[model samples]
Target: MMGWLWAVQVILFAAGTGLGMSDARRKSTEVRLPLWVRMLISLTLTAAAFALWRDDPASSSKEWIFWGMAWSFIGDLSMAGIIPWRHPMIGGMLTFAVAHVFYIAAFAAALHHEGLDLMNAGLAVVAVFYGLVLIAAWLLLIRNPDAPRLFNIGSLVYGLWIGAMASAAAAMAWSLGGALWLTAVGGLLFVVSDTIIGAAAIGGRLLRHQGYWVWLTYVAAQMCIVYAFTL
Candidate 1:
């Protein structure tokens, strides 16, 4: 039963990606995916993923990451709905921000289970990278006159939290030499996807060019995270 549920979840996610691609492929047409349909599919897949560890989640770190992935699923659906209505842009960004926070919590919990020290050389490198991201986000906000103040801030907060979470995971020391590396990679991919989305939103870049790149990155990010949880 667990195996079948997992298989179905993957198929659902794959179909979602195919839908996203189809949306991208239809150029010169104002084709947007049905908001409710996507939401329902995403939510159902998430629930199925969670069912794997429903019996004993505390004993399975993979389950914890799946919970975080569920948050991310919700965020992705909200963000996809934002521009179509234009009324929920801020709400969507906030949802995604909260989702990243959940991811941070999951990563931190995994690191704790590994008994990894917070202060380390890898962490220091990530700290420097994180500082650069902050400065870059600040610069983007300062220079962009059309950017919404609140959503821009929300993007920054999301980026910072995700960076910290990825850093923590990367530096963690596991007892058996491997610990949630897939999750860490997934988190990093999500950071890239979100960063691109934020830049496209504020900088007015990538609009004139191809639209598929943006959505592709978004799909890739989500798929990576999903696979991470299953791994």
Candidate 2:
């Protein structure tokens, strides 16, 4: 029944995403939903999921994952709705970034008192990669003055945060020698999702059939990431 619940959660999330995209296609901006309503729905679902995992206390990984999902839904809702009050739109991105950090913490907690040498080196390498990719993304986006500065900066922060999580997971795997390959893949999907969004925000008009590719890429990215966290 608990597994079924998680499956239902996935279905709801998919439906919401599809509906949101359909809305996007019809309307340039997303239709607004109240933030409190969104938060309540997310909280209720998360509480149910948490109840399912209570029996298996050893699977602490799922706890982090559960909260991550909660935060994700909130962030998604936050991004979708336009608040009447003056608020920083980037707050949603920042909140999601923090959620990714929780995922990193979960991966780290999974480590069994391992030494930090290998992990530190891995983190350093991932940091370098993150910097390089950020630079490339900005260089590409900033060429056009019309490109939203907020969008570019948000992408940079998101990329770096997810990159760090991926690196942390990789480092944990190296230290413990377990099958956490999904973490790395999840990080790659983050890149894929952001790249699609960036393309749409920048050269989408120039690119032929940008809408189809963007939709496909973003959906795939989300699906990959959802499964990655479940792993």
Candidate 3:
């Protein structure tokens, strides 16, 4: 039953991604179909993933991941909604920031259960590498006058949390001697997806089919994170 549910989730996610990409490629400003369709599909996928892992006996990390997914669902909804906030992107950024916090907590919990050595030289190297990337991202976003001041600050904070999450996942994978590749890959892809998003948002420039790439990487990243626990 669990396997079938996961299959369904994958299928739904693929369908949602297709629809979203098609919508993004449309030349018309007015959307023919509602964006909520894809958002609902994404929410359902995360819910199914959570249900599949709800009874895991291995560690409480699964619960934290579930919360992260839940927060991601809310972030998606907030991003799609037509709210009249002063800074429109703030709602989505705040929700995703909470989601990243949950993801970081989940990865930390997994690291604890595996008894990985955080002080390992490789882990230190990974930390320093991502630390530099985070610093670069901070400078890029902060210097963008096109983005609202509050949004720039929010993006910087959220970027730090996500970078930390990725660093933690990489450290765990290294400490475990390459057994947790899913977490590492997922964390890296998540960072890539958000980096693209931040760049597009701040620079006000859309690359070719940017939305398609963004959603594709983002969905795959979330799925990989969910699948990491099954290993």
lDDT of each: 0.57, 0.57, 0.71
RMSD of each: 4.1, 5.4, 3.2
Q: Which candidate gets the maximum lDDT versus the true structure?
A: 3
Q: Write the per-residue lDDT of candidate 3 for residues 184-218, one digit (tens) a residue.
A: 78888888888778777775655666666677687
Candidate 2 runs further than 4 Å off? 1-55, 58-60, 82-89, 112-118, 141-144, 147-151, 202-231
Candidate 1 vs candidate 2: which has greater TM-score? 1
Question: Could you estimate the TM-score for every candidate?
Answer: 0.72, 0.64, 0.83
Q: Which one wins by lDDT: 1 or 3? A: 3
- TM-score result, candidate 2: 0.64
Off by over 4 Å in 3: 17-34, 82-86, 117-120, 137-142, 177-179
Best by TM-score: 3
Candidates sorted by lDDT, best first = 3, 1, 2
Rate residue 195 of model 1 by lDDT.
63
